[model samples]
Target: MTDDRRRRGLEMMRQVYGWEVGDAPGDFFGITVDHLFADIWSRPGLSMRDRRLLLLGVLAARGLNDVLDIQIPAALANSELTAAELREIAIFLTHYVGWPLGARLSVQIDTLIAEHERKRH
Candidate 1:
C-alpha cells in the first residue's frame, strides 16, 4: 500500500511540479514523498487544485520561501492556479500573513510566472 501510494504521489507531483521524489537529498525529501505526497496528497476529499491552493497559502503564511520557489511555478505551469489568482491570493493573505511576507510572496510568484512563460516558448 505504501509503495502504491508513493508511486501515485510521485505521478501527481510530477504532473504538478515536474520534480521527482529523489531529485533532492535529505530525510525531509523522503518525508515529503512518504507523508506529504503519499499521505496527505493522496486523500480523496480535496481536488488536487484545491490542495495546491491550500499548500500555497499555508507555505506563504509560514514564510516557507524556498518551498514556494518550487510550488509557485509548478502551480502556474500546471494551471492549478493563474497569475491573477495568485496575485489575489497574495493580497488576501497579506492581512493574515503580514504585509512583508505576502508582498514577498507576490513578487516571487510574479517572477516564477515569468519563468514559466519563458519555458513554454
Candidate 2:
C-alpha cells in the first residue's frame, strides 16, 4: 500500500475511532487501511459523519454491541452525533428493529453518552 493511503487511513481512524491506527495487526488491518479507507471511504458522496451514523444503526440492529461501544462514543466525541440524536435513533428504531433490540441499544447508548460526558472534564 502507498504511504498516502496509510496516512489518510490513519486520519480517518482517528476521526472515527478516537485513536491512532497502530502498527498493522495483520493483513486485515492492511486491507482496511489501504482499501476500505483510502479507496472506498475516499469516494465523493457520503460525509464521514453520515457514514458513522449509518454504521451505528447497522451495528445496533445486528446486536454488534462491542462495536457499538466503540462507535457510539466515538461518534459523539467526534461531534458526528449528538446524544439527543442517538437517543432518537434508538427510539425510532424501536418500531423497525423491535423493542428488545432497541431497548438494549437505548441502554447502551445512554451508558456511552454518560461515559463521553465524564471524559470531557
Candidate 3:
C-alpha cells in the first residue's frame, strides 16, 4: 500500500463506513478491502476497475457472499466502475457462478441501494 492510497483508503473507511481505529489493530492486515486496494489495485499491471472486478470474482468464487454484498458496490463506487458496468459484470457472473449467487448479489445490491436511500430520506 502506497502511503497516498493507504491514507485515502483509511480516510474513506472512516468517512464512509464510520470505521474506528487508531493505529489499526493487527487483526486488520488484509481482512477487508484496504490491503487489496492499496497493494493489489495499485499494481501497475492492473487497472483499478479491473482489480475490483478481480476481487469481486474472488469474493464470489469463494462464497464470500456477505462480504461481496458490501464490497461489490463499494468497489464500484470507489474504483470508477459505473453502474452499467457493474450490472454487466454481474450478468457475466451468472453463467459461471450460477443464477442463485447472481440473484443473491442483485438482491444485496438492491438492499444496499434501499438502505442508502433510507439514510438519505
Cα lDDT tens digits for candidate 3, 44-92: 8866556567878877666687777667656544645655566676778
Model 1, residue 52: what's the lDDT? Answer: 86
Off by over 4 Å in 1: 20-31
Instruction: Please write out the lDDT profile of model 2 over residues 38-115, one tens digit for every residue.
Output: 777777899988898788778878889899989998888788889999999999987777889999999999999999
The ten-residue window of minimal lDDT in model 2 covers: 14-23
Which has the better TM-score: candidate 2, or candidate 3?
2
Task: Please provide, for model 1 over 26-107, each residue's C-alpha lDDT reduced to its tens digit, 9 standing for 90 to 100.
Answer: 6777678767777777788998789888888899999999999988887887788888998888889988999899889889
Instruction: Give residue 41's error in model 1 in angstroms.
Output: 0.4
- Where model 3 places Cα greater than 4 Å from the true spot, the runs are 1-22, 27-38, 116-121
Q: Each model's TM-score, in the order given? A: 0.82, 0.93, 0.63
Whole-model lDDT per candidate? 0.82, 0.85, 0.61
Q: Which candidate ranks first by lDDT, i.e. highest?
A: 2
Between candidates 1 and 2, which one is better according to TM-score? 2
Tell me how far the alpha carbon of residue 35 in candidate 1 is from the true structure, in angstroms, after superposition.
3.3
